[model samples]
Target: MSGKFLPTARFLLIVSLLSSALAVTPSAGAQAEPALQTHDVPVAGGPSGEAAQRLADRLGRSHTAGIYLDRTEHRFVITATDERTAEAVENAGAIPRRVTYDTAYLDSIKKRLDTNFKTPGTMWGIDVLANRVVVRADSTVGKKDFAALKKFLAPYGSAARVIRVGGKTERTSSAINGGDYIENGVVSCSYGFTVRKKTDPTYKAILTAGHCTITSGTDWRKSDGTYIGYTTGHNFSNGNDFGLIRAYNSSVTYYGNVEAEGGTAQDISYSRDSRLYETVCASGYKSKYACNSVGLKNQTINYTDGSQVTGMDVAFICRDHGDSGGPLFAGDAALGLLSGSNNSACYSYYQPVNEALAWYGMEVF
Candidate 1:
């Protein structure tokens, strides 16, 4: 959800959430923790990190129970339901733990909840650590809906848990077209990542929040009202929040670096997935450079407006107005695009950059 449409009521909800005991903490141990082995494995959010995630995905598809990143160990921890799968995980260089429910069982539970108990302010997704589906409900979910959700999960018993989070999720659109912001005549947003179409390297484009392009036309401009490009594609409130802007002007520049908080530029070398408990930094017009540790992965956030966004990366990064569609990265590795935040700007969510690039057939250059 975008930050633009948040109302006063939701702002209060954010305050409450922030005060809740469930708020995420920083990862001091994440950096100081000793490595399990002397040999270097891929750091989380690196190429090896991607490989680890893909390996975990394959294991999950093969009905593995759960998978999580052991950041300190620099390896994935997989839960295998059987001896054969445990042996396979050991051979694949992952630490294996025994568990009962496999990915297939967890996925079936999620499907049942989606098909029968779907509610406006409710969402559910796999939580690898718990080996169960985590169901989240926002402030907008009424008692009746929450009750229904509980009843639906009753069959699964301990396989699911419902939790309350602060603030109603909303699309972070509504930046007025003006100087210093990427604009589309009626609205403006922060540029996410500069890219070229995978099929045509010559075609330059910029990625941003898809809701930023919900206006009438695709024409785009810079903050100074300088014409830059047009929206070639966009997706919102339907699984992902990303948009592609194809530049028409040769004079326009696409930088290989992200603007740091103090006006410094940090070069991006590659893109990787966000890891749990890892520190991440975000840059946007309103908040500039803000850093925070990662919280949850594969989170499903329900907005008050009856829209539910799944597979969001939750972080403690602060965000405010006009920060939508900005870059969320960890050092040189690109991670995600700023999607929305709680009212207090204490916490935020991002659409994973890898998924966006794959969906749009584009790559960050």
Candidate 2:
């Protein structure tokens, strides 16, 4: 069964069907907010309002100040500032599981290769139950990667399974987290950009997490810039944590890459046709910077907010607040921007850059 050859189209169709069958009882307002493509599946058991409070105490705010759950999967994801915190969260039993490749649940890559399709390294799974995707990517991925995804679902069930990008698939990373990195702001990192008109060097406008704005505005951009605007509007405990940022003027220009070691800007150029398996890196205030491979792209996800974002992707390791609205890329090409993600800290959520540009009326080329 492993080596059997099945038509690519039919393979994806089967997977889609299985995914649909796994739907759980999702929060009604989840769609306009986050991922894990929940609601499609139904969750029967969960803790209630009072029970939720007792559980919160066990979780501990230091390790889970930002943790949450998808109404469907009912799995708690813990947010941490570092790997040590992640471990602590696990030890404390704040999260039912830890983020590790090939540990418990199968990683997305292994799942994709099981099928006859040839997918790039950037392949991941949308946890229809947990309301999140088992994502891990650092760089880029394209159609070839997507083609293999369908065939990977044959053993799950029988139905018309097709893995295609829909309106719900990809989403705008809160630029208050994009790259112009409009990708994740999630599963781990959020991208922040200099959204100034094509003129000034002083970042006139900036993007970040709506949640980030909710507590403090001077977390990341302090001496580098000033406050552009509050999280004028945001979604929380529901869907996406993205918000709009307004500035005095459009002084922000595309510095392009983020400032790496010694204040050097890294080059990033992402395309829809980019490869999946590639070494990639990220820069932000959280871990300073870290590296990983792009295992998948365009996966569906469910955030603690209980919303499902169709096209959001997931990363392997951990990240924190300062890292929110950062950048994820391979070489000079761009991939996704940061967005609100799992409380697990190891999983970074990203939004597609293309969609962010379209929504904000910005350009990346």
Candidate 3:
């Protein structure tokens, strides 16, 4: 079911129920934070989280601009433009708050900035909670460029906010690695989700980081240097960093499961859009499977080397080298592909799996 069909009240009840069901004990290694307070709402069950996400997407497509799942309250809080939109949200069983800027306007602001300022150290995207477009510049943003960007966006007024993000964002690529390692020469990276072309289900391919494929014609190999496939499609620039490897060995088996930290495999049933405050897990060669809470959505990251990637999601999950191209999942749903991380490895960004699938016309196996 899509988000449009869920009643706001029923959605909250369902969320509350699911949250209770899936509540996990904090792993000893998990850094604990204070629990967020919940809204005073009666709990009940109605739809799944995926259904709530669909409703959110539907609202997002309408006059409503932004939506975030309040995990503590077990409900979605929506931002709308008018009384009519608010009423509509109430009718759909969501909590609606009136906001001045809709998502379209915020997205337009981002587009305009992208067109006017190709500054390498800066990135911008819609921040749903603030109901505004947020532009972040890393330490590498020179004084001249930062000032120029500020001047360019000044006319946008309060519609945008510029902030400084510490450390440089760089592509996560190095040797280490276990989601089944794929090696090219001496370089090693983890395999992402296995996929099949929409037009030919029998045609198998593996998804990975495009930066890993920068050296064209480099045949991908197994850990022992056995031939596996070659990089078929890649896009490390122009806003995305995903690559596809067409596997020649039809006998190569890829299950719809992710190997967790303890060698157990978790089944992947589907793919869904990520929401703020939601719990997610990642599996990489270096870090294995680690679960963490998602903190941001629709973010843009600027690399120190001057490359910029937009439409990314961030989480307070640990990652390291050889983690790029790994999978980021929520329950059984595929969410994103590991892209890059900040200087601390404590936080990482992902390329949404939906975008990559749409771009490649492929589906997870």
- Candidate 1 local Cα displacement, residue 290, angstroms: 2.3
TM-score leader: 3
Give the range where candidate 1 is weakest over 10 consecutive residues by summed lDDT: 30-39
Model 2, residue 149: what's the lDDT?
47
TM-scores, all models, native as reference: 0.79, 0.42, 0.80
Backbone clash total, candidate 2: 101
Of candidates 3 and 2, the better by TM-score? 3
Candidate 1, residues 123-202, lDDT tens digits: the string is: 56776655678777767778888887888788887777677755555556565634357877677678888877889988
The runs of at least 3 residues in candidate 2 whose Cα sits more than 4 Å from the true structure, single-residue gaps closed, are 1-191, 196-204, 210-225, 228-242, 247-254, 261-263, 268-274, 341-345
Tell me how far the alpha carbon of residue 99 in candidate 3 is from the true structure, in angstroms, after superposition: 2.3
lDDT of 3 by residue, 35-150 (tens): 22222332123223455455557767547776666664566666777888788766767667677778788888888887777676565777665567877676677888888877
RMSD of each: 7.8, 18.5, 7.4
Question: Model 3 TM-score?
Answer: 0.80
How many backbone clashes are present in model 1?
12
Stretches of model 3 off by over 4 angstroms after superposition: 1-62, 175-180, 250-252
- Candidate 2 lDDT over residue span 199-227, tens digit each: 43343444455455444332333423432
